[model samples]
Target chain A: MPKIVDHEERRAEIVAATMRVIERLGLDGATVREIAQEAGLSRSVLAHYFTNKAQILVTAHQTAFAAVRDRIAAQRAEIGDPVELLRVALEEAVPVDARRMLEANIDVAFWEFARHDPELRAIRLDSHLQAVEMWESMARDVQAAGSARDGIDVEAFGVETQLVIDGTSLQAVLFPEAMPPERQLAVVATHLRRVLRQ
Target chain B: MPKIVDHEERRAEIVAATMRVIERLGLDGATVREIAQEAGLSRSVLAHYFTNKAQILVTAHQTAFAAVRDRIAAQRAEIGDPVELLRVALEEAVPVDARRMLEANIDVAFWEFARHDPELRAIRLDSHLQAVEMWESMARDVQAAGSARDGIDVEAFGVETQLVIDGTSLQAVLFPEAMPPERQLAVVATHLRRVLRQ
Candidate 1:
């Protein structure tokens, strides 16, 4: 019998290696050779999984987003309160721990890289739209459930809420000590409370 | 007679060249040769002005910040209302024009670059603190003038305001067409009005 090749597993392994290389050497320094070395695989083997460095980067980004999405989904599965669900979902986006710190570093590098790459830019914009939609849907659901205030423009509120989360995440990554996990959560809570009905 | 050399003018010229190179070719691509070529100066001449690429990057950042500061000061000199002044100051920070777009590009690059360089990291942290302090002072002034609400935590309020501005600025730069100047200003105005007492 022929041996079974787990293509998905192999691809994920390569992406995991790519993340490690990026964290250690930034985008500029994350050369193919360095990534292969970090993965303990030959450059040719790595190339079999990814066409080039840029492909790996895009995959890395997708992997990161998927991981966060999974975590949020898992949390949502357990929560029943609409307000608490939204709060936890937003708070999960903040970089307050080791996993998030790594994600933020990769995100920062990707933003800089995306400035010149059209494909990467598209991926970024698409991801942003998805995030905005997620928040808008949540806000609408909560409002319908009477937990959130009526008369609030759900779309604008969603945009502003995303702005605060993205902004707070950036600050948290840039100044971890100044913006601890608790502080980040507090900012999100403050904004949500301000908009939610008493 | 000795040649009267304007060191500051020459440095400014090099920084301008660096910015152009950064705009055309990202931070990694804006090498010594490319910058020298862009400025119409030889490599040796460029070397005479700055020691390395890092120094040039630092100078470029300072130039960008100074330009924004000067613009804000000019606008402030003509405005009398404290609320209006605060609005104008915060609005000026947004990248609503070509010049600001270039600054944003450089800023995005610098932020990623600063992740590893301790000296650059220090500069970034210091600049952030300065921005926070400036916003805090402006918030206090506006609140004291009875334009803003009382019993509000000015420090936390200022930090949140800065977060919104910085976050919105990032989004505007990333998606200019989606987030036009008018939209950017509207978002900031909305946040300010929400916090201010009617």
Candidate 2:
């Protein structure tokens, strides 16, 4: 191995560049050339990594989901309490960083493509499933921690939380002034507390 | 006067057809020819009503919003409780009829176009503003009814509700199995109950 670079880490770097292109130029302008330019690599090198633009978008989404999942899991370990964990995990998805904002932009871009592109649709569905599963785990953990009320449907609750988080992300993106981070987090926390069976 | 038909009603009918065309075909597919064909009218006649496709999409969105507003306003007379009235109004946006589905499809189509079209972006921003205003009205009603809790930011609450509704609509379209009508309503109720001060 010349440098012994981590394949996964390099892939993530390229994906992050793809997101920057999306944020600056919408999906219409996120061409392979532009993405490669943003990534500081030649189109040939980018092509070597990803066969096409769709593959690049899909890979970026996969990497974003993995990042989110790992971030939440790590938080789960740090915060042993269910309510606190739920609040923290939910807030993590909000676009608090350039990376999260990039994730949101890429997500919105792919959604339009999903309507007409089967490959994009499959990737979007898989991402949603992964999110739901992660939330499901969080819900179960909350219930087990004794913070949630008895008779709570962890699966259903997980779905509900996912809906709110997803919805909040969209709103924050569209109307950042109105849905500031503090306000979004507060609204989410209040709603989450109420969903508990108590 | 050749019968002097209700211009507003006829315009709405045409806009409704616009939504149907968008639902069947993607935004790019919903051209003047297609809409005119669907509306059972000549392209010239459609042009007389709306100068271009942009105007048609805007009018269709207006018509959809009007239907939602009228439904909620009408419910206001029969229902005095703010929470219950808001609940019913929110549920009305869910996919209860083909019309609602068509409206949602049109929204998604326009959103896709908005990424590339400035006029459509303005329309979307206007729609979001109108929604916020409508929610503020509902929030005020809740407070006036003495059901709202103290220190609740009505505007923020309104924005959050809109986010949930928007999110629900997206989910209903993308993952019908996961976000059915009954489940969506339950989540709406959960949010309402949680945020209400009383």
> What is the DockQ score, from 0 to 1, of model 2?
0.55
Question: Per-residue CA lDDT of candidate 2, range A1-198, in tens?
Answer: 634466666677887887677778866687889989998989888887877767767776776778888998898789877778878888788776667866776677667767778778877887887788878887887777677776777777778777877777776666566667777778677667654654
lDDT of 2 by residue, B18-65 (tens): 877777875668788998899898989888887776777677777777
Worst-scoring 10-residue span by lDDT in model 1 chain A = A1-10
What lDDT score is found at residue B153 in candidate 1? 77
Compose the digit string of candidate 1's lDDT tens values, residues B1-198.
233366667777888888888877766687888888888989998888777777777877888888887887787688877788888887888888878877776676667668778799889778777777777887887888888875777888778887887788778877776678887887888777755885
lDDT score of residue A25 within candidate 2:
82
**Deviation from native of the Cα of residue B183 in model 1, angstroms:** 2.5
Where model 1 places Cα greater than 4 Å from the true spot, the runs are: A1-5, A13-42, B1-5, B16-41
What local lDDT score does residue A59 receive in model 2, on the 0 to 100 scale? 71
lDDT of 2 at A79: 88
True contacts kept of 1: 0.61
* Candidate 2, residue A114: how far the Cα is off, in Å: 1.5
